[model samples]
Target: MPGSPAQAPAEPSAAVRSAAAAAWWTRWWVRVLAIFVASRVVTTVILLIFAANQGQNPWTGPKPDYFSFATIWDGLWYNIIAVSGYPSTLPTDGGHVTENAWAFMPVYPGVVNAVMFVTRLSWAPASVLVSVACGAGAALVFHRLLRRVGLSESTALFAIVLFCVAPVSPLFQVSYAESLGILLLAVALLLLVERRYGWLFPVTLVMAFTRPSGLAFALALGLHVIYRWVRRGTDPFPVRERVLSVSLTVFSGLAGLAWPAIAGLVTGSWTAYTDTELAWRAAYIGYVHLVPFAPWFQGAQWWSTVMLGIPGWVGIVALVVIVALYAVLLFSPPVRRLGPDLLFWVIAYSVYLFAVFFPQSSTFRLLLPLFPLLGVLALPRSRVYRVLMVVLFLAMQVGWIAICWGVAGADWSPP
Candidate 1:
């Protein structure tokens, strides 16, 4: 009996437990974390440099002691609304600017104001809190998505870092809608992974209401679901799922349109922003023709004034690159084994971004949800495919940073 049934060893000791926890930090993920931190620091430096070069603005400028500068143009107005709720509009052309119509969607500012009321924190600290919390949420979203895609913990950490600290990701770390938008986006992605299409609507509705960018995302996801169903010749979703998904997506689309629509009504018209655009959006149509191709414009223009923009040639190259790469990513082997389930969200995201072509909206920001779409192209099994992925990874990080500090989100004008 003694020879046949020796007892198993006891549980790990307290010291061993501590040692194992310490060892966990030494995993491959630790390297990824280190690289991510380095990337963030570099991006932060770039933001400071950009702020320093801005000459001066009495309202907003670099910190006096070089503490660090963050927040972009739209961030200021969002902060204003947070500090003091939207002032009663006095009527400009349509509704009054004081109505906060031009500031941004209400959700982020509402949070800012709520925090001020409850915690009695100032705008500066509150803004920082918004940014940090949202940034962490975005990181978690990427981590979950990467895990869903079967990436190792280390690679997932790298991607999460890119999403969190990379230059393009500053929006997540500021008082802007980017961070909140990211959290909802992550929740939506997780729901999608769980096949919880029912959540897509409410989540997307909140997202759409929170940020106009969310509308674009909602539309993209909606179309993707519809397209898959159409392709299958049978309803790709169960009857209840189909009804709920479509209904929610429809609601989201309308919710995005509602604020503008209501703003129009309040102003005794239905297109205040469009009117604002008409006064300044002359070349917008011509610009859309450049879509799915290259952005030929040198700098994005507002009020007939142009600023530096992404090279049209670069846009052309990036377009080709997006297509050629995603082509391979779309039909890879291991992923192919997972079939439609694997690509559902990616396809949805791509369709959403593709659904819009205008310059007035944040279609590019919508691309954040499409990160996985971009990752799809990197899914193949090959040396060349793998190398291309490395290049793409580095390029995305650099490109994001350029957009944040260098390109200046190109679309937004400072409040």
Candidate 2:
């Protein structure tokens, strides 16, 4: 009697069913979210401990309260833009540019304002909410991108941990545009990897308005298109598809220039954005020069004139070492391992940074966009190596937060 098809098995009881439902948390995204939350907790604790040790009461503030510490510096500017829209005319001091909202991009603040409108929350909380949510999305997209690029799941997840704990990662949690910019950049690149060029247009457009780093993405996509064209003898796409791809690439590159153009149009000056950026240079370095490596020469000359001692020589030597390290990294195996699109993007981005921007403590924050390159660390399969790197990353996070954000007064670093 029992041998007749075995009764096709009975349904599990309610307790067993509930247990199975709970087990659904074992999915990959669930794990990713868990790691993200845990990492944020660790970072927050570190920030709290350091702020306390520095005798700073994070709870009370004239500006950046405890809940709003992440919204300091440029983030404060974003808040202003969110609360009060950008002024039509730039503030100028005797024909020289002064601090203005034009320097900060709009997307981050726009989202914050929208959040405020919808939730009726204050600017600080709304800004932080936008950042945290975008940061979480970026983490998930980054993990997926790494896996899509052929890394094993373990390697991809490790890269995510490394990224979330990296020294500059606090920026991701802040009210700055880095979180939104990174999210857009990751999405654009992921779409490119999937060969969905048309979708890249809008994403890159939004990215352009988010950060100047959007130019890096546009260049990356353009280079990728050219790479494909060069290999056209074995080309996979038909003529129509190829034309569409090239059109998208060109459109994306143009979109990267749109924000600056808009700023120019708004201010009735072609050099509005550049002039505003140069104001900082004028204050710090006397005059702004358009020539490449001008900042390096100017920095060297200024250092030599000011220090006039072993400290001067040490500064020059340190500068040389940093430049040399960047050169080495340009061709390093680890950097090359970032694959063609990323390799080109990093190279173009680094060239732009070095050529146009002066090096400072905030340069580290600028390098946050290069988080994709951290995938190189995942190449090592050794447990000891991974453990050591994790330790180093966590330590650097503490150091960066303390030195750059805590100890250094405003204007020492842009953070």
Worst 10 residues of 1 by lDDT: 287-296
Candidate 1 TM-score to native = 0.68
Can you list the residue pairs that collide in candidate 2?
Answer: none
Q: Per-residue lDDT tens digits of candidate 1, residues 161-200? A: 4454432565655556777877787777777656687667
Q: Give me the overall lDDT of model 2.
A: 0.77
Lowest summed-lDDT stretch of 10 residues in model 2?
A: 55-64
lDDT by residue (102-206, candidate 2, tens digit) is 888888999888898999998778887888899899999998888887777888888988988899887767778989998998897788878887787788788
Residue runs of model 1 more than 4 Å from their true location after superposition: 1-15, 23-42, 49-54, 61-68, 83-100, 227-236, 276-366, 374-415
